[model samples]
Target: MIRYAPWKVASIILGTLVAILLVIPSLLPVSTRESLARAAPWLPARAIVLGLDLQGGAHVLLEVDTPSVVRSRVEALRDDVRRALREDQVKLTGGIGLQAKGVQLRIPDPADRAKALPKLRQLAQPLGASLTGAVSDFTVNEGDDGVVQLMLTDAGIDARVRRAVDQSIEVLRRRVDALGTTEPNIQREGNDRILVEVPGLQDAQRLKDILGTTAKLEFRLVGDSGANPGDVEQLPYYKASEGSGTLPVEKRVMVQGEDLTDAQPGFDSRTSEPVVNFRFNLRGGQQFGQVTAENVGKPFAIVLDEKIVSAPRILGPITGGSGQISGNFTVQGANDLAVLLRAGALPAKLTIVEERTVGPGLGEDSINAGKRAAYVAAILVLGYMLLTYGVFGVFADIALGVHILLIFAFMVLLGATLTLPGIAGIVFTIGVAVDANVLIYERIREEAHSGRSILQSLDTGFKRAFATIIDSNVTMFVAAAILYLFGSGPVRGFAVSLGLGILTSVVTAVTMTRMMIALWYRWKRPTVLPI
Candidate 1:
């Protein structure tokens, strides 16, 4: 165990030096690190990322709007029902009646009801594949007097809610990423809630505004003065200066925002006002061109989140697939809208249930407390090792220092976030870093007392204690892995640090300490063991 090769010794020394260098940037002041980065861009300037608890930022808990989800699903079901009846040539006594859960319609003729029943049943698609079986999204039921009702199933609503939460998470992630914050924590909390944590961001309100806006954009024709009341609805005009009242717009959508391929913020050429320029996909472009060609000289409304943003008359067919949106917008407002359009709309509205801004002052206090705890841990551990074993203890103390350095170096390389619990994990690892060394030293002492020679005792001690060290570290590593896989937030941070510390401690305590002892023995040819 004490034997070493020339390359092995050189490699060990080189690795120690590299680890020290990797940790140096993290130890430096922020100003110094920035200056170094500017002076020499090739140097490793990346440091450990601090978690929200350590570097204080925004914490927001948002809940998906259930009612909005249900309403949208019902409206979509109504459209599907209308299309199915028109395709089957079935006559209805009244329009498809909208309900909170689903839609209903009455087929006055018994023959038409028989024909429509089969067609409407086909509209109830399977929600998703499940272990139990394929579950339909809607149930078609026959009522009295040739009336039929299509109701959304409970499982279907849950499935839709789950999908909305998943899509909203991705959309919110994209929007948050555009803000250029580092290491933002965006994840689902419960079935309906999403928790977002952005470290080092001070603009809590801006984050909320960007996240809360549904940004559902649609294009539809402005209803004619004599249009049927049922075909048009009064949507509030978004422009306050023009009028605070409503504009009558057709219920049919000409184009949807989902078809947008790109959106950017720019200034209007004629008015020099801030605006959002958007381009559509191939299908959307064709639909837009067809609509513009059919509705020339007619006004169309640009609607956003159920409100009319603008109503402009179509001059001619626009086949270029690109258009601009002009509203009473400042530069920032235009940019925000462009961001939302590019990110895509949320599946449903999200209401903020909880919001908090963590100031940097509390983070500073936490960092200071962590630092003090770490310092005290190192001092106590080093002092204990020194007093326990004479010269051999010094080697163990040096290895412990190297272990700490390796932990931080690994974290920096992996871009791990450090939290308060992570600091506690580090301190705890300091106390255990010398466990292997202690075992070896104690075994060596027993061998020496049994009248064994110094070299024989050292070799026998390490070889005998090696298996125990590995066994203990392996169990701890498994525990850390489990904690990391199942835990969230601060628990995850602690797991990361603890896991890294375990691996590093094994390397330093076993290999490096043995190497130091071997070199010391060769140089001094000690007649008696230190312990």
Candidate 2:
């Protein structure tokens, strides 16, 4: 058997006893709890409670509605295509993009295809020039006799998906941020789905409801300008609003918020009026400047979501790139407007597939259960190590203590919120980590029995076992990382903590433990081991 000096044996035993002592206060009063939270923050072997998956809670999966989003975008494209073709005097018959493909038209004569195909491509110019520049991508394939076909490209569909997904993600982020919840996990699932998990959320329905709706706002000019009186000769650049909800009747807007660079709810420094201040970009500023300059002293509507909110006559050129919007708004109303403006308009609708309430009561019980399991598992591991290896078990336990410290320090550094599954992952990790120590100790015993000296025995034991430990643990860590990348919510929690544990375990069990043993051997030079 391998030999350890009496001092080395005593020191290992003493250190483990002290670590156990340090953990005792967590069972005591509130004063002790606060003290423990701050003590030795780097390697807290303390048990951190987890979420429902660890203790016991329901798991929910969300499916994104992609078809709905695609249809909405196609419909909008159809409208734009029709309007542009009519404006260009292209006699187009039948459907637009949302129909068979992107666009379709029955030419009056076969020769019309020559002029129509090229012009239709131009009409679809807003789609982008890169794809349509080539006739093959834009396509005018002859149908049997003479009918030509136009179809949307795969690249165009991919482009639309990307835009829709981006818009959905931005809106979701706003809704979640406003909830004031901690560590809510939200991520894009596949090309069209969004995955979100809120810990300690008793009622998740409200969040889902808020996220699923496509709240869109649009500004459109309405009514005939002929009936309107005032500056018929001057052509008052501002049109009066003709609709409702911030959109003024008989007035036209000089500029809309889409051209804005930023919007925020704030009080006017001079007047203290609750208002939304918006600033336009360079191009938008120029457009606004031109519009206001042309319509000086003429009415203009400030519209939001197809409704006219304000109608004010243009005074002069607004070239400062910024302006204030003040209405009969409370602070909350202004804040809401700011939020809506910042989030912009949703590109496509989200249809909810699943939603459920996760009560706080359910969450608390999970925390209690996860903590209990962790404590029980830790005790079992400690007992097994001591009983199996006798004195060397104490050394393994010390290394394990170091592993726990590094793991907690890592979690705190990353600001990772620990769920119950995460705690279970840590518990499972301890089992794997302890196995490495068992392998090393058995190797050490083999070397000692072969009549090697104590120093020589340890050196050979660590060296022989190092390769196996590194290779096995590294492979497992890789698997966990892959799962975390693809898995949602608690599965992700499991992967993150498990992966972290592997790194911490390798350092403590092999390097740090060996250094301590090597240092002891140099000073003591003992002849026999306690085990």
Candidate 3:
């Protein structure tokens, strides 16, 4: 279709531009990433929303255990009540029961209620715990028979939920930041659930795994599982792990998951088997050596959640401030376990309530939409140019083509994500770009009609049009900069397009298009311009 095409040099340039567009973004090197960010100071390097699927990151939904929070508060209140009663020397009988929303306590006599009233106020002062719907001014309204009662005021279950939510926000913030990921998206989805999204993550499961580990490191004696209470006492610590699981007498562990500074997977020196080796720092090291020294030759089990992963027989005192957990493991499996242990365990458990993976179908759909939009815009721009300038419209189209090709190369070179929105921006640029060339062409036409040589007309057109083109493009560039500065997600994408459009349009209209005109003039210096 392209007969008597431009010089081999021009074709090479065009081909290189196309190749860059087609290849670069997909294979963006780390160095190029930084350079692009540096080059386009307007297009921010940060503040872009990198989806989980595009970046291979993790996402998590955390549901706060509100019931536990409520109960814990109630129990603390009960403790305060008991302490206040003791302080006031009130004869308190029985204990306290937590009902659906309120608490009921058993007391001896109505007279005792009066005696306990002052102490109750003192204790309730700190509770800040309020009553449900009823205003708990807790008036000590004594009946005709001198009967008194404790009542509640404003605050209730809702208040507790609010406090819990606030605390949860703080804790979750700490947890996510501890992970060392880039600005993670942690937002409250509803009242109880928190949604977290992380980009450039290696493992999504790591989120659950880290959040799940209770991190409760405890050490108890692992005695014979089959032993009776007396037998457990007689059999010592090592025998407990021998029988366990279903009805076996479980032994308590003496040491726990804590007290470890570093852990890693390594081959056992004596036997070429995989094992997790861990070492303790200053304080833990001293404690570990003391424990082992006091109980030399005694078998201790390495238990995880009541199940024994391994229990190597103790031979002499391990005074080296380090230990190994040997098991039958492949190299990769061992390494993964080591990494998990090193990061420490999670505080609360997490469940995967929802999952949506953006597969290739979505990617393809985006690509199709983007291409369609671009095609439509390109067609309209070409048609308008053809109508406005007639024959020279073809030249503008060629220049427009080169402009687009260069933009793609620029996107690839800069590692700008070719998002569907990004595609829309690129397509939109095509239409806006022709305005620059239109100005120059219109100027040239006016010059040619005024009885000037074609050469003089061309010179006047470019020289006069350059100022107007620069002025208009500078405003657009400023607008794009502001949009990018404040916009997020898709809005940011539009800004990126607008900003980049100004630069490429100037280049294609001024330099590339001028080169084309120069070649055309050299080949045939027509007396009158083609237009």
Candidate 4:
């Protein structure tokens, strides 16, 4: 135990050197690191990412619009019911009746009701698989007088809201990523809300705009003079610089924005105006071609969020699956629209219920405070070990320094975000790091006083304390893992630092310190052990 092979000694030296090199870029100034990166592109230039709390950014809490989600689901169910009845040749006495939670219709013939019952029941999809069983999204109820009601269950609504939140998170993530920010935290807060944290982004309003836009695009035919009143509805038409007015449009959607595969900002060749160009998938392309081919010389409306952006007549069949939208958009407006289209529409509307912006000044103050606390902690730990253990204390202090370097190196490589709580975790671990050394040193003192030789005492002391060290560190590591798994934001940051510190501390406190002592003993051949 007192001796190490030459390869082992060489490995220790090489590892420490590599860790120092990895941590050096983080310690350097941003400008210096950038210069170094430009000069030597092969070198690693990554530094530890600072969390929102330490870097100042936007914090937005958005709640999914439950009413909108329910309304959408009901409308979709109405469409499905209509399609089912038409396809099955089961005639209804009246139009599909819209309800707050679902739809209803009347089938006068008992045979038609019997035929429609199974068809409508087929529309009820299984929500998802679970331990107990799968539940249907909606229930089909048949009442007397041939009246049938389709009601959405509460569990179904809850499940839809949950799914909307999940999809919204992904959409928001894509939108935020387009801004070129680093390490944004986008996660679900609860069943119906999402919490977004963007580090180093001070433009809260822009973030809100990007997140709030539903970007629901649709294409439908303009209502002709002879069209039925119930088949058409008046929607607001948005004309640039001309004020908004109403235009009658058909209710049937020809194509939806979900079929769009890509969107880009470009200029209109004829008018030299900014526009958004979009390409649709094969299914949408086929539908679009068929509609345009049959509707030549008729007007079609391009709608976004129920507002008409443009109403242009179908000149001919556009078989290429690509089209452009012109609405007198500015360059920035065109770009923003393209981004939204590329990110895809949110499953439901999201309202920003809470917003806060952290200023850089406050972030700077936090960073300084954390540095002071860490410096004080290092000084106290180093001074205490020196005063208590003399020359051996110096060895422990060196190991402690190496442990810190290893922690920073690991964080840099992993790209972990450092928060104020993370700094506190590092300080707390600094004190905990030397506990193993304390245990070993005290054990050595006991053995030497019991009349064992200095070499025998050192060997027995390390072996005896090693198990206790592993047991305690393992417990702490498990606790850190639990915290990381269940906690969010700052708590997670603290857990990361604590978990990493535990790993490095074990190496430094046990392996590195023992190696130093072994080298010292072999070289000096000391008569008495230093206490």
- Which candidate should be chosen as best, given TM-score against the real structure? 4
The root-mean-square deviation over C-alpha atoms between each candidate and the true structure, in angstroms, is 2.2, 7.4, 10.3, 2.0
lDDT by residue (152-252, candidate 3, tens digit) is 33354445555555555554555556667765656666666666766556566766655544343433344665667743432222224364332222344
lDDT tens per residue, model 4, 238-345 = 776678888899999999889999999999999899999999999999888999999999889999888888888899999999998888788978888889999999
Q: What TM-score does candidate 3 get on C-alpha atoms?
A: 0.53
Per-residue lDDT of 176 in model 3: 56
Q: Ranking under lDDT, best-scoring first?
A: 4, 1, 2, 3
lDDT of 1 by residue, 115-233 (tens): 98988888898978878888779999999988899999988888888889999999999999988898998988878999999999989999999999999999999997588998999
- Model 1 bad stretches (over 4 Å): 29-31, 108-110, 240-243
How accurate locally is residue 257 in candidate 3, as Cα lDDT from 0 to 100? Answer: 69
Better of 1 and 3 by TM-score: 1
RMSD of 3: 10.3
Per residue, candidate 2 scores C-alpha lDDT tens digits across 1-531 of: 134466765765565555455545434565666676678555443433344443232223454455655556555656665675566566644543245445555655556556656665664433444545632223444564435455666666666666677667777677666656555666776776666666655555556555654534222233344655432111212223332222224443445567777778899888797988888889778877787777677755565544445455668877788776666568877876766666665666666565555666766677678779888988999999999876578877878876775666566557566777788888898898788998888888898999998877888889999999999998999999998988877788889899999988897788657756766666667788545
**Cα RMSD for predicted model 2:** 7.4
**Sorted on TM-score, highest at the top, how do the candidates line up?**
4, 1, 2, 3
List, in order, the clash count of every candidate structure. 0, 26, 17, 0
Better of 1 and 2 by lDDT: 1
Candidate 2 is scored at a TM of 0.73
TM-scores for all candidates?
A: 0.94, 0.73, 0.53, 0.95
Worst 10 residues of 2 by lDDT: 231-240
Residue 207 miss distance in model 3 (angstroms)? 7.1
